[model samples]
Target: MLHKFQQFYPDLERLINFIAISDEYVAKAPSQERFLEVIIRLEREVFGTAKMRGPRVASLRVGEPKNLRDCYDTYKAQKRETVEQVTLELETTVRTLVTDVS
Candidate 1:
């Protein structure tokens, strides 16, 4: 459990950092899904869980760069939509909780 926790943040941080500077990576991808595949693989490697691949396509690979840009629209629209929906839900839940507390 401790090992899992320790690995989680760094890996997730790497994912965010990779996404931030991923223009070069995404540009090199043969397809958007292929790029996301790279991300999924990284997540598994860092987190040691196929579950991290989540609902995203399970096209894991090694030594490929990926990005969030075309992972939607040209890639997988549902992934973006899912993220947006989750963001909205979290925001709404937080707002409601704050309002009730006050």
Candidate 2:
């Protein structure tokens, strides 16, 4: 799959190679910032300059919190009620009895 991608986007060969090796050493997916960095670099390479004058195809901030704490808090609040509901279901399941021995 990656070989075919490299063949198609020949200009990204070096970036793809770097990412493959980095993945081996990092053992984790790249962060959003890293993804944006790659996109910006590719845009600059293809356009011959870092064009920041018009609307962009990609952006670093897409309405997401600047830090993990804010994002976590937002999601935690949204999921709190769901978590309570799941806990009640689990407790009920645990207390139920199965009479059929077969």
Candidate 3:
């Protein structure tokens, strides 16, 4: 998965690698809550308020596992949408440029 993303989305691949390595390190936390906290902090740093952190902050007052999962799902959905929108805009811009040149 990381390899496939490397060519077109190096930044995303790097973020995935960082998250995987971070999870491995945080896996040794003394408590599950501690592990979750560390994971959330790492995610917040990577994804920030524009993506995942906003929903996490608004909906995750309590650290329930279900809420965490929900927030993650929301983050994934929003990220996917944002990527698609950017790709579409880039394609449109390129097409317009090509048409103008022709």
Candidate 4:
């Protein structure tokens, strides 16, 4: 469990980027749905279960170029306001599609 937890954030981020890009390119909704289905299945294998929220993508530069871990640590160090805004935006978007049965 601990080992999986360590890798979860990056894995999660990848899933977010995949979903975000796929949606933005609506001309290929089939391609996006196909990829998302595959990723969802794979994630269940690796991490048991995940709940989709909004999508998040960032070009973050973590300190200590040699240390990828430092990059995530820097992500954690970012200001609270920036983080919350991004989170809320994603939630709103995701929820709209998720609840839109029309």
Candidate 5:
């Protein structure tokens, strides 16, 4: 799964490493609640949000405004921005994880 992801998104190595290390921590957590708490905190610290919540843009309606018809394009642009931001944050988060692990 990871190899496939890397093949498609070569710049995501750091984010993937963060997820891998986080998975290990989550597996070793004492309870599901504890794991959730840790993950939520880590996400808040790294991404500045408790959870990455919501679609990049809200759903469009059948009779949406003319400008709103470009919802798909808006979503794509927002998704790209979010990906860039997450990649930047994950680079620092992964470095922190590596230091802690060492």
Candidate 6:
């Protein structure tokens, strides 16, 4: 399963691109969540499955957007020129996520 990442894309390349090119507030993301997200993307796209590391590697394939590369590239481009807008958007997003909308 790990080999899938090797087949799909280079880790260094993806990390470099994600950190250098991503426009999202991914750097501000909670550490564990960020790690999970990165691992999930790498596993699903490259290995065709995702799983936790263990004595037995149980992986399952999940659907991924064909435009993943595009999405990633766009996300990288999402930087706000103004800090105020960036702060407000982050606050709003957090609020929405926390709000109960049943």
**Highest lDDT scorer:** 1
Error of model 6, residue 33, in angstroms:
1.9
lDDT of 1 by residue, 20-77 (tens): 5455666776686767666666656566653533465433223223354644563364
- Give the root-mean-square deviation of each candidate in angstroms: 15.6, 18.2, 16.8, 14.7, 16.5, 15.5
lDDT of 3 at 67: 31
| Window of ten residues with lowest summed lDDT in model 3 | 57-66
- Global CA lDDT of candidate 2, please? 0.52
- Candidate 2 local lDDT, residue 77: 74
- What are the runs in model 4 whose C-alpha is more than 4 Å off? 1-78
Candidate 4: lDDT of 85? Answer: 59
Model 1, CA-based lDDT? 0.60
Q: Per-residue lDDT of 1-102 in model 3, one digit per residue for the tens?
A: 877756767567556655665545655656755655665656655776223333232222222122334346555779777567656766776676666656
Give the alpha carbon lDDT tens digit for every residue of 1-102 in model 2.
888876877557555644544433433566655655555556665765455545445322222223435446555777776556655765554444222211
- Candidate 5 residue lDDT tens string, 1-102: 888866865346445645555555666657756655666666655765576554434232232123434455655779777566655666766676666656
Off by over 4 Å in 6: 1-25, 54-102
lDDT of 5: 0.57
What TM-score, over all chains together, does every model reach?
Answer: 0.26, 0.25, 0.26, 0.28, 0.24, 0.28
Report, for all candidates in order, the number of backbone clashes. Answer: 0, 0, 0, 1, 0, 3
User: Model 2 compared with the native: what TM-score?
Assistant: 0.25
What lDDT would each prediction earn against the true structure? 0.60, 0.52, 0.56, 0.58, 0.57, 0.56
Candidate 1 TM-score, C-alpha based: 0.26
lDDT of 6: 0.56
In the range 11-102, model 6's lDDT, one tens digit per residue, is: 56556545653425357665656656666666765765677764444344333224434345445666443445555666676566556341
Error of 4 at 83 (Å): 1.6
What lDDT is reached at residue 14 by model 3? 52
* TM-score of model number 6: 0.28
